[model samples]
Structure formats: structure tokens, C-alpha cells
Target: MGDENTPLGAPQLAREAKDLVELANTEETVSELLRRGLDWLTRIARFDLATLFLLREARLVAVAARGPLANARVRGHVLDLAAFPMVRQALETRRARAFTEEDHSGEGDPFDGVLDLPPGHSCMVVPLCSGERCYGVLTLDRSECETYPQTVVDLVEVYGQLLATALQNAEQRSDFERLHRQDHEHAKLLESQLGGDSEGVLETSLSPAMRDLARRARQVAETDTPVLLLGETGTGKERLARAIHRWSSRADHPFVTINCAAIPAGLLESELFGHVKGAFTGATKDRAGRFQMAHGGTLLLDEVGELPVELQAKLLRALQEKTFEPVGSDRTVRADVRILAATHVDLQQAIAQRRFREDLYYRLSVFPLRLPPLRERLEDLPQLCAFLLDEQARRTGRRGMRVLPEALARLGAYDWPGNLRELANVLERATILSRGPELGPQALDLPTHVRAPEAPAEKLAEDKPGKVPTLAAVQREHILRVLALTKGRIYGPGGAAQLLGLKPSTLQSRMKKLGIARQELFIIEGPT
Candidate 1:
């Protein structure tokens, strides 16, 4: 067995190599492959000890051990490159080295304090190398009373080569899986962004301001940065947040929302960070919080300005560390969520008053977007009305419902204090009351309490250049004058509705649809 020329030795080595190749090919996991390889070496090669150390995080880790030390403690033992010179030399030179009693003269013993080599035992360290890279070092030990065969050393070297190939294949497979997962996640986000089966839509088509806002939102949608949406109430901040989620890489995952102001302060922490089964009274079972539920996706923190000061520090820590412990659990869970914060409150003022944390604000406002109010984007009224009227028509069993120019002028004249939400409410009401093909001024009796555009010094100046008074405008003006004359009364005999030849309810609905307010009209009674 010690002579390489022995005819039987070649066939035995060939069979051992074939068995190892089959084992390496069949095992899927790296740990399993190493375990089987060590077992084969200990049994077939008659080694007293066999250990497989693989490179991990720039160090060699004892992934599998057999023979004398087959305990759990030996499996994860980590060896630094500088601590073991024999393993280092084997790895660097890409060659197997043998240490025997006769070869240990002046060197004293390189294996001393390094490996627990049994007394009167010989050892061989083989590099598990393929191509130019060495994956790790394989060590085998046996009694020195019998000569260690050169055939056995060659067989171990061949096994090391096959192990290196297996390790590389396993690593490549892991990389492929990771990339596939990332691609799947990206696809989901794109699908949502493209409005996949979702009722949400960005109304940026009719207004340049909205278009700009959408453009900025799209720019930051692919990143993991926190977004702060600043706008007045009813400006569609939540809708914009949804758009960001759809466009982000995490679109495939959940998009969870939490209204801080709507929830009680006492329950906010548990709601955000989750809790164990016995975290508090009435806690029947464990539940995931919004943060955990929104993992790998977007979390919309609506009215985030309402979060209490004490919770701000916790939130900041989670955002910074990407980890948080459940209410009653000592285990820290990871957070892989993108945050979108929406609020109508003045955060700067809140910070100044010590009601909000400055650090939290900075974290939340990494990319801030301010939505324009409806009054500032009146040019979009026609498109907005068209979309809204279509929605109203669908809801009210009406078809082809179009807004007259006069009705649009009436709508464009007033300041929409409630923004898009108010507009939707008014249009919905008008659709319910309309009995004609076109939505006329009579069908849009706007509230008389909101501010109207300042009247020009003269009636001629109000019309654009050569623009004549359309019947709608004339009707709107007439209705306003009568409402003022009746002191904003709509019901009864002397009411504006009676004078306008309409039912009181129909007239009231029209006023709401028109964005008119009696107080606003009365305020401008003496003006042009």
C-alpha cells in the first residue's frame, strides 16, 4: 500500500475517488457535502481523525469533524489565517504537507499548541484548491506505528480537489438564488407602479405642479430613503405615497399604513413594534405590528407628526439600526421596510415647540415632496372635472355626463379650501341631483361660505379680453345675487330655491357642487 507502483492500489484509489465524486455531486448544501466527505475519509482511508475547514468571512471555519472529536463544539471552531501556519502554508502553496516524527528535528513541532495530534501519530494537511483559489485546508491523522501510504495521500488530494469544485458550485447556486429573489421583488414593484389591478391613480396629467411632484416622487421611488409628503388636508398625500410604493423596489411586498393621530398613544408602540402573547392584558396571542407587517415593502406613517416624543427616540433607533425588539420579546427582529410619512401639520413648528424630535424629522424628511393645493392649480379643473364626472356618472348610473363651460368657470372662481376631497364630495352630490345631459351652473350650487376670487373693478375686466358672458356665468351670478337677497336661505317661500324654480334640496346640492359659500359671497357683496 505504501508503494505508488502497486497495481491494486490504483484500482482502490480510483474506486474511492469515484465514490467521493458521487457523494459530492449528490449533496446540495455545503455543510452536508463536507460532512459526507469527512465520513468517507475516516472510514475508507482509516484516518483516526478527519476535519474539514472551509473559508467563511475571511477565516477558516471547522464546518465538519469526524473520528475522535465529533462534537458540536468542534463543528463551528474558527481558525484565523495567522494562528495556524501549517494550514496557511498548505492553502498558500496549494499542496499537501506531511509531518512525521522523523521530520520534526530542529523545528520542534509546528503542530504543537496548533492541533491536538495524538502521540505517535502522523498527519497530512491537504489544500482543497481548484484553479487559482483555495477554499480551505483538509487535515487527516493516523497512527505513526504503521507507515502512511503515498497512495492514501494521493487519494485524499483527489478528494480535496472534488470538494473544492463542490464548494464553488454551491456558492454559485446561492448567488443565483439571491439574484432571482431580487428580480422577483423588482418585478412586483414595477407591476404595482404601473397600476396593476389597483384603484389608485396619480392625477398629474392636468397640472404642471402635480406633474413636477410626480416626477420628483418617481426619482426617489427606487431607493430605500424615507420620504416626507407635505400638503394640506385632502391633497392626496396618501395617494402619492402609494405611487411611491408602487414605483419602489419593494412594491411586491405589503404597503401598510398607520394613522398615528387616529390611534391611541398608549397602544402606538405595540402597534408599531409588535408584541409577544403576554405582552399586555387582553393580549390573546402574538401579533405582528405594522412595521413587521410592512417588511420588505413600504410603510405609510400618516399623521406622523402626531407620534409622541417618547416614541420618537425608539422609532429613530429602529430606522437607524434596521432592528427592533417586540414589546415583550428579548429577541431583536430585523426591519427591511421603506418609510413614507404624510402630514398636514407643520413639523418645523412642532420641533420648535418640542412636540416632535428634530432627529426624527430629519430622518423622515430625507426626500420631501409638497403637493400643490387645488386653488393654485385651477388650470387643471377641466381635466379634473372630466375624470371626476366620469367617476360620478359610473356611481350614479348616469352616462356621458359633461360639464358646461359656465359650470367650470363657476368651479374655477372659488378657492377650494378642502382641496381634492372637497371637489370629489361636491361632484358626487351634483351627479346625484343632475337630470340633464350637461352639468350646468344650476346643478352646481356651490357653498356660499368659501372665499371667491376677488371681483374685477369692472364687470368687463372679469371676462378674458373679448370673452362674452356665457349663460352659465349669468345663471351663476343670478343665483348668487338671489341667495344674497334671501340672506342665504334656500328652503321656504322666500328662499333662493323658490325664486330659482327648483326644489330646496336640489338647490342646496347644486350650491355644494359649485364650491360657493354664502359667507364668502357676502364678504364680497360691496366689491366689484
Candidate 2:
């Protein structure tokens, strides 16, 4: 407010501009974003009376106005711009400057109607422009100032520029989001048309985290490191492993997977290193183990933590030197297999307890990569959902795929116990049951907590039978249940709809309607 520049520094200005661009490129409605931007900017500028008026299709309507005297009566009382020479000049010039008497030096008309100052009143109108073109005007007023100062004039100009840039960013953001959405749709269209492997998971990710993973995978795919992927179950560890294999130097060869937990200890060694024909009873013929089969290629061991203690030693040896002997034969059958391992269990804990070998843990964890949990990246939900919806539509042969605001709202309210796998399944179910084009709440099969409890059995038995659980009721129960499950991670995990479904705006709506807040659930746990 004091300097010619706004309070924001160069870095802050750039960041705000970037944020506006990001917001503009979003799929959110422009009106909603504009209102939010206006609401926030009013506070940011610290101007008591601020109004944003733009020329829309040759007519100007004040879209966003703030401060005290902005009601119908105050706004309706208007002076003719042409009759007031100063107002006309400000609009015509398309640049920020004071409309005070100093500019004219008393050579112009009295400026009675528009510039008639109230007690201790002063005003400044700054033109909002972008690249030499006028976008709109910002009128800032204060009650205690005697006259518009030069410093105030300059600050207002900077403020106007900031707002204009922000508005531009919002528009650009909207376009980018629309393009991204269309890209997903295009991918689905290609999938359905070409439909080769329906089981292959489509990467609908737009989040930097996911895109960055893809980039890193592509970069390191040529290497022969024994990549150890660490993440929770249902977090797409297998998907990433497969992606690595598909992109790596061993892409032409077989990519084999062995779930260490699934096979027995006795069979695991035989399965991995292969058994000679005469190795044991009922050893019908010579067999090639996963390592031999994946020679000069990639071998993925899933749930590596669950591997038997005895087998861990052998697995380590094979990973170190890439050579193994069949169960019955003494000769070593060398295969150039690149090892990749995935685990959901805590290998360190297993090692400490002596349930898992420490050396094997070190060998596997040498090139460890940890995938982030879904809760850490709520911003990517909308994109993720859109991608999943398209995927479901492609597989099931239905374009009747759409996620209702309410379903998305309810989804955002809860935590995803199953992670991406759960999200995919829910989307698939919704797509399958979609009754109409909208794919509304009816399509969803959300958990009991996400829905209101079925109206009392007594109420159903007594006569007023067809009463559906009100939207408000469903929202209320959903909020409360998630609060309990997550211990009230209002902004935390256990799927707060805003956090879960990735629609903070929509979740906000439901939270308001249901009369729920963080405080309601924060009551002392001492009561019965």
C-alpha cells in the first residue's frame, strides 16, 4: 500500500500469476472461480470498497463488488459516465491515473454528480489492462482520506495489473484443464476402437507425481538395477513394475512375476531355480524357472517380504551373480535376469524380528522407491476419477459414464482404504449401474458410511414406505462416519469427501448442507 509496487514481491507475483493460470485451466466453473478470486482479492488488497466492472458484450455489469455500500440501492444510483468528463477520460484512456482535480487543474466541469465527496471521502479508479488492452476498471474508496495521493494512485495501478493477470491466468487454466479432459476422452476412444488388451491399466494420471514417475521410469528403464518398489497394497506398485519392464532394455524378452507369499517354501525354490526331471517324485519333465524364462529380461517378485526365510538366502545369491542351478542338476544354468521386487510389508520390522534375513533386506532395498499415499495428493483426484471413469467405460462398452457432483462429493468425504484399486473398482461399479446419462448418485455403490442408514425398518413396515434418504441426511451420516474412521481427519485421510473424492468445492457444499464441521466431531471423548 505504501510503495508503487504491491505487497507481493517478484517471486510472489509470479507465484500468484501461476496460481491464477492453474485455477483458470481447471474444469471448475468460471463463475465459481471468479467469485472466489474476487472474494479473496478483496481481502488481499485491503480495500474497503472494491468493485470489478467489465464491459461484457457492449454492456457493463458489476460482476464482483465488495465493501459496505454495494447493495442494490447504492449500486443502482449511478451517474452518467459521459456527463462526467473525468470518468469518460479514465475509461477511454485505458490506463490507471487519478480522476482528481489536479489532473484537470480546474479547467474542466465542476465534476459535481460523480466526484461529490462525502465527509472524509476520497476515491481512485484504476484501469485494469492486459498488454495495452483495457480489461476492466477497479474503483477503490476510503472514508478517512482527504484526497487521492500519488502513492495511492500508483499502488492501485499495480493492484489492477495484478487482478488482470490473475483473471487471465484463470482463463488459461480453464482451457488447459479442458484440453486435459479431452485428452483422456481421446485415449478412451482409441482404446475402445483398438481394444487389444482390455486388462492393461490405462494411465490417466495428470498429476506431476504420476507424470514424474513415468518420466523417471523411462529415464532409468535402460539400467539393470534391481529396482525395489516400496508402497502400500493397491497402490499400483505392480503397475509401475510392469511399466518399467515394458520400457526397459529387456522389453523384447519375457517379464515374469512371482508372488513370494503365494507359493509354499518347498515349491518356491523349485519354482524359482527350476527342478531337474529326476529331482523329485512326480517331476514329470525338466522345467525352466521364472529366472531362466526371464533370461536377458526382467523378473518381478511381488510381496517380496512374504518370501520364506530359507528362500531369501537363495534369492539374494541369484540377484548378486545372476546364476542358479536346478534342484537335481549340479551344473549352473546362468541367466541374465534383472531383478525387480515389490513389497507392502515392513522389511525392516521383518528383519528385526528375524522373520526375514537382514542381508536380503539390504540387497532388495538398495534401490528402493516409495510411492506416495493417495491422501498426500488430493489435488489429483478429479483427474484420477476422470481417467478411471473413461477406463471403466472403455472396458464395459458404455459411454453412460459420468460421476455426479454428489457421488464425487460423497467419494471425497471418505478415505480410500484400498487406494487406487478401490477407486478403480468403485468407478467400474458406478459405470456399470449408471441408469441415465448423468451417472448420478444412483450409479454409485459407496459404502454404508457414505450413505445415510436405510430409514428405520419400523418406518418401512408402518406405511409411508417410499421415502428415500434425503441428500442432507446421507451427507450428515457420511461426514460423521468418516470422522470416526479417520478420527476426524477433516483435512486428513480416511476419506474426508473433500480429501477423498478430490472435489474440495463440492465437498464444501455438502459439509455446509449437512451442518458438519471439524468442531462438531471434536467433542471430548469422555461422554457415554
Candidate 3:
């Protein structure tokens, strides 16, 4: 050896350097990779403590720690840039800084207050720099009155460079994976919005109301103006929102959505505006929220009326200024997202009730489109059934499934209080229950009180000559047939009332007017 206190030989340093490079290249998650790097640092440099802090939002957040302070729960904790002089020196000068108890160079250092190192411990800190940017800082400390070897210092500097590159790679991989997932989900949503009809052959609705609504949506989609969708629950506001996105200039970009009512009020702000690391107890890492993710795209705020009062002002600011700072951060981020809001709740009433902001409502409703409920657009029933059944068939692997004409007619008669969503549930359930290629009235099991609509001339033309059934006549026939099938039992399980999906009392009244006697019908022995 050159000297008794000499550092490791050049050959040994070279070997360890090669190993560190190999370790950094391994396929692992960011956290796992960082943990393993810390372990390797301990073995190679023989440090009593090693901690890694990554820069996020101009603060160094503790990501990994080891040694005497290893038991400390400092991971996910943040340290201000100016609070630690040694760390600041290392970062700004792009060099390693070492200090011993005897040196007393940093007697008034802020890190002295933050870090409670034991007496006689020497510490070394290095900046993780790659090119011009410092990725983070690495610290090593030992509870001994000895200085770290020159070779060890050199190795740590190299390690910092390697770690920075590794972190950048890992972050890129993570971003790619997240974007891939978002793209896959958006593709599925787009397919659904197109009604799985890639050729554009399927019509959304033939009803004049819906046609007018679609026309308006297409007209406004080319602009960056905010669009508000107003409709009753399940009236397909989300679908309309998708249509607008597809027709917009940002059609190729992401279309993110959030249901204000579905998420808790306390978390909505964080979900929309993101949060810096250590912003909250569980916010371990920096996350780009919906606004960031939807940059250069569209964001649909469904159930917008459910937004809490306190957040309304912040939302209005974001809408007006297109910039918002993440929670616990002072820096503002630009939001280049087109806003689309959809809600069934009456915004005017909500404003009058002091539950919503009128300015925000005006901003959102720059181009408003109101969708008529299914009951009002009954003319579109046949087409809606076809489109819904096609989707259900594809999902259930029941290809080429169809509904019987009479069943379709019966479905058009009911007042669908729950709108399209309810219709979809009913159709999916019917598809799952039916055994044949065609679903009939038995598969429908509609409530008898919901009578079919008046038969149009075309429907009457399909009837037997001179025997076109009126709405009342069809109701009577449907009720009488149900009674006969139930062996004239009028109430309870398997009774005429139950089979017809009618309340027992209502079925009895209909029977009395139709001249069906109690003697002619079997009375079930149970409560009506």
C-alpha cells in the first residue's frame, strides 16, 4: 500500500463503481430502487447513517434513510431548501461537503436543529447532479471520530450522478405506464360513446329534441368555450359530454372526468389540483391531478352542482384564470384544459339557495345544452333499445340478440323515471335472464300500471284486419292474460298481480272494471 491510511485501491474502486452502475440499471420501482441503493451505500461506504432526499416543489423530501436515524420516521417528510446550510452548499456548488465535531465550521447551522446526530458523529452530504439540474441530495454520517476516505468520497459523488439518472429513468417509466392506462380507458369510453358503431351507422336518437341537442353540441364543439350539460339523472349527459369532446379540436387528447358527488368534499380539491409530497399524511409522492393530466385536453366535471361552497371560489378562479397552485404549494401551474360541466341539479335554484356560485355557473354555461328525458323522447325508444341491446349482447357474449316487437312496444310505453341508466340496467338484466335469441314481454316483466303509449298508425297497420288494439284494449288483454297465467290468483307470489308487476290493489281495480270477478279469480291466502 502507498500509505497506512490510504483509500481503497483504484482497481477496487473501479469494481465497486461498476457494481453501483449495474445496481442502478436494474428493473425496480422508484422506492424499491432507492431503498436498495441506500443498502448498497451502507455496505460499500460503511456509513452509520445514510439518507436520500428528493427535490419536489423546491423542497427536499426524505425518501430513504438508514443507520442510527433509520428508526426515525422521516421518510415522506420535507425539508426547506434554506433550512440546511450544508445541503444548500452541496446543491448550489455541486460538490460534496464534509464536517466533523472538531471542525465546528457549522456551529450555527440550521441542520443542527433539524438533525439530532449523536456526539462525535461526522457527516458528509453530496448533491445528486445530472448535467445542470440537481435531482436531490444524499447524506451519510458515522458516529466515530474519523474522516471518510478520499476514495469513498469519490465513489459517493459518482453514486449521486448514477442515482439522478436512475431516478429520471424510473420517473419516465412510471409516467409512461400511467399514460398508457389512461389511454386504454379513454379508448374504451370513446368506443362506448360511438355506440360501438365505428362506421357511424347507428343513430343516437331520432327524436327532434335529441337531434336538436346533438346539433347544438356539434356546433359548439369546435370552440374552446366551456359547455354545460343540463338534464335529469341518467338522461345521458356524460354521453353528450363525450360527443362534444370527440367533435372538439382536442379529440385526440385525454378526456378526464370526475364526479363531484362521488368524491368526498374534503378530497375534491386535492383530486383536481394535485398536492406536493408531504402535503398530507398519506401523500407520499408528488402527483399530477386531473387538471394537469387533462392539459391540452378536456375535463368533464359531472355532478358539478355537488361541489362544496368553499371550493367554488377556487374553482371559479381556475376557470377564469386557467391557473391553480397545488395544495401546500405556492407555485401556480397553468391549466390548458377545456372545461365541460354536467349536472342534473338545477343550478339556478342552487344559486338562489346559496349553494352554487352564479359567476361560475355563467362561466360553465357559456354554451349550454339541455337533454330531454327518455319519456319526453319516446320516439327514440326503438333506436335506444337497439343500441343498448347491441352493447349488452357484445358484453354478455350473446351476439345477435334482439327484442321481440311486442316487448319493444311495451318498453316504449313506460315512463322511465331513471332515464337511460335505468333502461340499460333493465336491458342488461333481461339479456342475462333470456335463454333464446329474442327477448319477449316475459323477459321484460314491466309493471302493468305503466300502460303502453297510443299505437301509431304504422303499429295499427301491423295488427289483424279490423282488430287494431287500442291502448286501453291492450292493457285489458295484458292484464287478463296475466290473470289466466296465474290461474286467476290475484295477489302474492306467482299471483296475477305479481306477474303483471302491479300492486295487488291496483290489479284488483283493473280487474273489477274489466268484469273479472273474485269468483273467477283465485285469491291467495296472504296479506295483499
RMSD of 3: 18.3
Which ten residues in a row are the worst by lDDT in model 1? 194-203
Query: Which digits, one per residue and each the tens of the lDDT, describe model 3 over residues 1-528?
Result: 122146556686566566655655665578887887787665456676688998887689888887766655655567787655667778988887676665545444324555676665767788887776778899877767677766667767776777777667666777888999898788857656554542231135544567677777888888999999999999888877877887889977878999999999889999999999999899999988899999999999999999999999999999999999999899999989999999999999999999999999999999998988887766556567778888776676777777665565567667788898889888887877888878887898565676565889998778886675677777876665445444456767656566667799998888788776665444311224
> What are the runs in model 1 whose C-alpha is more than 4 Å off?
1-206, 389-400, 451-528
C-alpha lDDT of all candidate models, in order: 0.75, 0.66, 0.76
Cα lDDT tens digits for candidate 2, 1-528: 223334546575566566655665662675665555556555334555666666554334456666665555434333345444565567677656655446445444222343334543556677667765566566666554456666556555765676676666665677887998787577545534443322233243433466566666666677887788988888878777877776777766667889888998889998899998989998989998989988878889999898888787778888888887889999898999888899999988988889899888777776777776665444455556776667666667677456655566656665676787888888877766766667566676778764434778887688554566786787677565544434444453334654346465676677776787656656411123
Q: Which is the winner by TM-score between candidate 1 and candidate 2?
A: 1
Full candidate order by TM-score, most accurate first: 3, 1, 2
Top TM-score: which candidate number?
3
Q: Which number leads on lDDT? A: 3
Tell me how many clashing residue pairs each candidate has: 14, 16, 1
lDDT of 3: 0.76
